[model samples]
Target chain A: MTTELSLVADIGGTNTRLALSAAGVVLHDTVRRFQNEGRQLNDILDEYLAECCPDTKPHSACFALAGPISGDTGRMTNLAWTIHAPEIATRTSANRCILINDLQAQGYALPALAPDQLTPVLSAERDIRAPRLVVGLGTGYNAAFVLPIESGVLVPAAEAGHASLPAHTADGRKVVDWLLANLGQAQVEDALSGTGFAHIHAALHGEKATPPALLARCEDGEAKALKTLEVAIELLGGVVGDLALIFLPRGGIYLTGGFGQALTPWLRQPHLQTVFHDAFAAKGKISAIMQDFALSVIGDDFAALEGCALRVAQN
Target chain B: MTTELSLVADIGGTNTRLALSAAGVVLHDTVRRFQNEGRQLNDILDEYLAECCPDTKPHSACFALAGPISGDTGRMTNLAWTIHAPEIATRTSANRCILINDLQAQGYALPALAPDQLTPVLSAERDIRAPRLVVGLGTGYNAAFVLPIESGVLVPAAEAGHASLPAHTADGRKVVDWLLANLGQAQVEDALSGTGFAHIHAALHGEKATPPALLARCEDGEAKALKTLEVAIELLGGVVGDLALIFLPRGGIYLTGGFGQALTPWLRQPHLQTVFHDAFAAKGKISAIMQDFALSVIGDDFAALEGCALRVAQN
Candidate 1:
């Protein structure tokens, strides 16, 4: 049953992060990352196993992927690799293998996160039994809601980021209208992701700039860039608030993604919280429900891997 | 453990509907409705029991309420009645008493609904294991997501109607803006309920009219009233589509509530279906997910009572 050792992997579009763990606890020293340069997942697993466990093979394996997993197979949304759990188990000579969506993996990892691994942006009572939401703002954006149940937690698959972005202010409305005209739809991803920085920058200042350059410009006190970040943060707050009301995630709202991790400091500031509270406060009962939610950002990069280990341990 | 007989009630702001049941199956002949003019829920229950079950006392009771139930007590959202499950158990001489939110009761009833009780508005595959959404567009609007779990089902408390409404088209944006300016926020309830008809009528024609009157005018082929109905239906479609993307309720989208049932004919037409698809078609995967969902309008008015009985039976 893989009680002592298990192999866990978090497979993204560009890279795969792998680790060995015991009872869902990842061994930090055994962690490895591999780039997906036209290599199958089975090959990566073999390489990781040979390097990390030379004496004994892992008893089981569990994988988290940046794609949808149906039945025994998973197909990456951006990458070309197709993953099959049973096939991986056979190829790795493991007793069992399980695959789940990366967001669900992140959702599963929420309970195991240490205090140091999470930075709470909105401090409030944390009810462990309530639903918890994970909103990822990276290359593209998405979210997953983890529900605590009797037998096990249920992580409902969410495509919230693809839902249209809502405008909360006059300026926000103008920007959203312009995005809808130019992009055919004002998706939440259009305003809350790395690529979204370009849209915000272009909307604020009549030109496009890469997110890194934009962040650098803002750090140098560029007025236009600063406004762009404020607007982006405002949009992110609005979406998070909407989700809070929709899901009532009294457990917490976890922002997890490369972009979200980079904006940890900004997210913790009063401006984002103020905008978030204001958005939900437009409705009375929903306002109270949202105000009690604990908001945080994931500080650990290997959360998905940890979650995969957790699932493997559970199985 | 009342295995043979149970008393179930659906208590709303204006009235209470009570019935006797055996093993979660409601006895239609025993169903009774009482006005809630100035009395408490206990009083109404006492009167109902005295009238219907004078021969014997029910062994268990479950009540579906119009407000949030915290701990053992429930306070009505709009009415003055406050109900305690334990108190009801003591007063009614029942072995067990369970109190659940009305929307959750409706959600619990989803599995028991007959084919004739559900009008399929958007036809697609129905995966009973997936989450199902119940959106109430009656006097006051709200939604509940009924998630299928291993043990039973988990219907997380939802106040989704208060969430800000999203605009999909330029016309939708204009209506939403006007609504926001007039009502402080463009809540889904503002444009998807009975009161929404007056606002839509005033927006379309320069005057306000009752919902029934507006529906009558639309039936008589009045252009302005027809247009108002069209906009309201469009807004409902957009909200449903947004929820579909947010929750990915592959089990189905159930449109319950008085207004929704009354609009069943229009809701089943191609226009609402087209708008709903268009609202979700802004994103690729979300569009596909939404297209695969089953959308229906619930036809049962006593579904909440049935759900209460179901909860009692489960307990």
Candidate 2:
């Protein structure tokens, strides 16, 4: 085994995670998280390197950011950080550095994920050769299709979150209309993200509540909060079902992201599971084919680091 | 140059088009179309070969059919034809035979399309390396994404038409509601196909009118007919816009299928063009990126044959 080390980082709006990998495997012990706190990314990287790997320099590096990537540069969506590949290389003393979208990083981590890391929402026979999809429901909603080619995998970029929010039922349409009336547009992210949870709660209960607050209310047996959660799950099911038809991700559909992880218990509830599956499989003619797709929630928080490591190794 | 001949065919519900190709270039002079009149596909192929190219035998063949292809066999959506590759090889006296979806054939045809064969709806600088998309709006609605790989292009299968119909405007939502009430489901095809024209007409006017009759009314300067056409165009624009965001088809979006071709003149009109563009670019924050995708209507009826020829040569 080679002793050469590579650095990988996943940069989000509020925090940045840095980890060291050897032979494309992330070193969990060396993983470290830092709060953004308006600090420069360079300063954070310097501190992480000085503290985590005092005597070692990485040979290569990859950073996955929460915003769009054009060519070799990335901008954080909610922060004032502009990440450039050359700057990352210079700061980390790495020979090769790459930047990819955070969603793409999640996509790359799919094939490397262990079975225990996934909580099954819908278990079906897996077609290992078919494409897989990673749906991110976090601060913002988005998805990436993982195409398995002969060489490795191709994770194509998509702005599906900005697409229109689809409504099939009366309740769904009411929520969509609420989105249109209040947000001035009806987009998937407008109703499926963290803020989307608040929007749904406001739309249903005529009041404001944060996502965590709504969860607390649901724990307190609040009917409106429970209804909000059910509606959100159904919307997710419908959106994911539409994506399944488009991408035909027969390998699996892996739900990832902070908000997605938080909803795992609710998603696992038998009644809510049916709510999702019904909305998902409600296609008119070809609904039967929906059974071929297996759905799971990715429980691994370090999957993006794993993905960045994989990308660095591939390059 | 080798004088080896290859066979290519595009099989639709009503007609079957067959042609000969040499060196991956379709021979327009050898192209022939036969109406199905309740004839078997095998008999049609026999008659086509006997009439069109009696002197030459194709060394290989490819057929693009309007239906699902599982493995080496393809089942036609409208016709009672099961196209098995081995059977086709035996019937055509070809050593190799391949079957692909009709939309995929359209996808492969993109790179080889002549400028004269396409009419620009929204022209922009083409990104030669980016992915392309083919959206079909005929008897049924669907889209296929064309990924430009190192070797060739990969057109992934998609059943987008069977997904939910997205509505952002009052008029659009009304149409969606009508589709849901009438069809028990609101799918993209329910509002975007040949039959969808009739559905929109009925939804708006509360009267029955065939697609052709409605078109004639529009040509005759009927108000309701024009409104129906405009509404359908706007719906198409919205659906295509959503798809554009998801697929990021920077190369271009090529509108194919019979109904789409028929809508070209109206789509090109200045006022209607604005309507389409308005609906297509109405995505809230990311609306600007929609301008990056060029939209065009494919005018050539035999482009699928050209695609089959390309596929045959590729294999």
Candidate 3:
């Protein structure tokens, strides 16, 4: 049997990973790291192709660029790349070049992920036919929701990160107000992202506090660091509850992205579920029917890459 | 063409509207406005059918209820009515029966509504191809979101009203705290529904303010009443914004229900724009993309009735 190779690129803020595969099955796939901080996208692309697939005419390429991919011309928030699909297709000499939201790429990996990839955090054993929400907590918070339909699969792009964070406590309200005073807007992403952790830790542990340092201290079981993480996870779980109420993800909730990875280890802490169920327990409305839903974290790997491959298979 | 007549019901808290239609045209439709508050669903159905449909041996009937139609059993929050298709079929002697969400019934009306039936509030307008959001604000706040797919439509039940409201102001923060103290939970519906209005009015104008008087004063534009409505619209807009950001409504935001009818008059208020815009603007993530969306009131009369007719026509 003969196999054809296609190109796949997972475009991130700091690095650009390009690989070659056949029908989404990676074969001789490789990457070429670039300093997108300084160079042009074309320069990076030329270097990647030369190193990975020289003298080979690939069928097509799928570009999963970070930031918002609203239309044909997608611009990166952190990097200097303003990507155009048609333009990239011509430049790469490929048959097609499609762009999807990075979170959507993550959504594609929802089913591809195995039990080993996902560690059960707050298990609800949700209904299989129910819609599952894919929340990404990275440099920013975003969500991509998927529902099983009579048709096949449905993925809706979600900007839930900007949706207001529920302020249940006085301290929660204080964090909201403080973040608003500093950033002009109080949002879940502003309070739950890595930068959000730094902001909260800095407020508690002075200006020198950072997300990495806080995580390290929390690893050491530092009380103050643990407190900060508890509050962050509490807020994060609260938002997940809010999202679940809004979407009613019968398929269960899957958390992803870099921040999701960081928060994974801390999910089992008792205080997290306390805040989660507290917020989720809405009364006098659809609260009673809010059963059969639980939160879980997606297995860490190249979910985005797997998602991109999934999209190729789907399209 | 000789046509067959079927049973159709718009089951609500207070009354049930039953109609007999042939070839998707109503032959006889009347409201059997029975108080569902005191009676069992079976008793109400028995009483409702005896008066409404005397002589109809139809094939299939679709009952649009105001609750999650996850499976055979359906439960409504505002009333004591739980319906099952098989149960209704056995009693009514029907071939097939469906109990779908009321908002979903309204969603089926999306493709049928005329341009004149909509009163456009926002300016730019929506893409129409993207999934449209259908929101209901009547006896209580609830929502039913429908996703458009290539094969057909995917209507997902969302207790979106129970989603937490994000408070931005000191006044709002105080309100959030008060809700937590008094109501034990601070979900959005706790502040934005019909009951929520009563709570907001009480919170704003002491414990003595009544819904009838407050609504009347609001209608008369009395200062306090107007202020209450202002907060109501702002809170309403905030939730609308939340929904907009969640789905990025490409088909536009269709606000329905009696509450929507009340809000129709105040659609262009400055507070409405501020609260709604703040929900999207805070992200600075999908802000530009959001500008393309517009808000509108679904003004079609008896939309649920018309929706029932549509089901007959298409099915």
Superposed on all Cα atoms, the candidates' RMSDs to the truth, in angstroms, are 2.2, 2.0, 3.1
Better of 1 and 3 by TM-score: 1
Candidate scoring better on DockQ of 1 and 2: 2
Q: Model 3: how many Å of interface RMSD? A: 2.0
Residues B73-151 of candidate 3 have per-residue lDDT tens digits of 8887567667888988888777888777787788767776778999887766667678888888877666766667664
| lDDT tens readout by residue for model 1, B154-201 | 788777777777776656776777786787677777778888777767
* Residue B89 local lDDT, model 2: 89
DockQ by candidate, in order: 0.65, 0.79, 0.61
Residue A137, candidate 3: Cα error in Å is 0.8
In model 2 chain B, the worst 10-residue window by lDDT is B149-158
TM-score of every candidate relative to the true structure? 0.95, 0.96, 0.90
In candidate 3, stretches whose alpha carbon ends up further than 4 angstroms from where it belongs are A1-5, A24-35, A47-56, A204-208, A271-291, B1-6, B20-56, B269-287, B308-315
In terms of TM-score, how similar is model 3 to the real structure? 0.90
User: Model 2, B1-315: lDDT tens per residue?
Assistant: 667889899999999999999878899898888897778888988998898778878999989999988779998988888889999889989999989999999998888899999999997888889989999999998899999877678887778888888887778878887887898888999999999999988888899999999999999989999999999999999999999988888899999999999999999999999999999999998898888999999988888998888878775
Per-candidate count of clashing residue pairs (backbone under 3 Å): 0, 0, 2
Give lDDT tens digits, candidate 1, residues A1-315.
Answer: 435788888999999999988977899999999999879877888898789888887889888988777678998988988899998888777798888889889998987899999897778898887888999888878899898876556787777777777785876876787787778778888888999888977876779799999988877989888788888877777777778777888888899999999888766668655665565455644566666888889988989998887778775
Q: Please give the RMSD of candidate 2 to the true structure.
A: 2.0
Q: For candidate 1, what is the DockQ?
A: 0.65
Q: Where's the lowest-lDDT run of ten residues in candidate 2 chain A?
A: A168-177
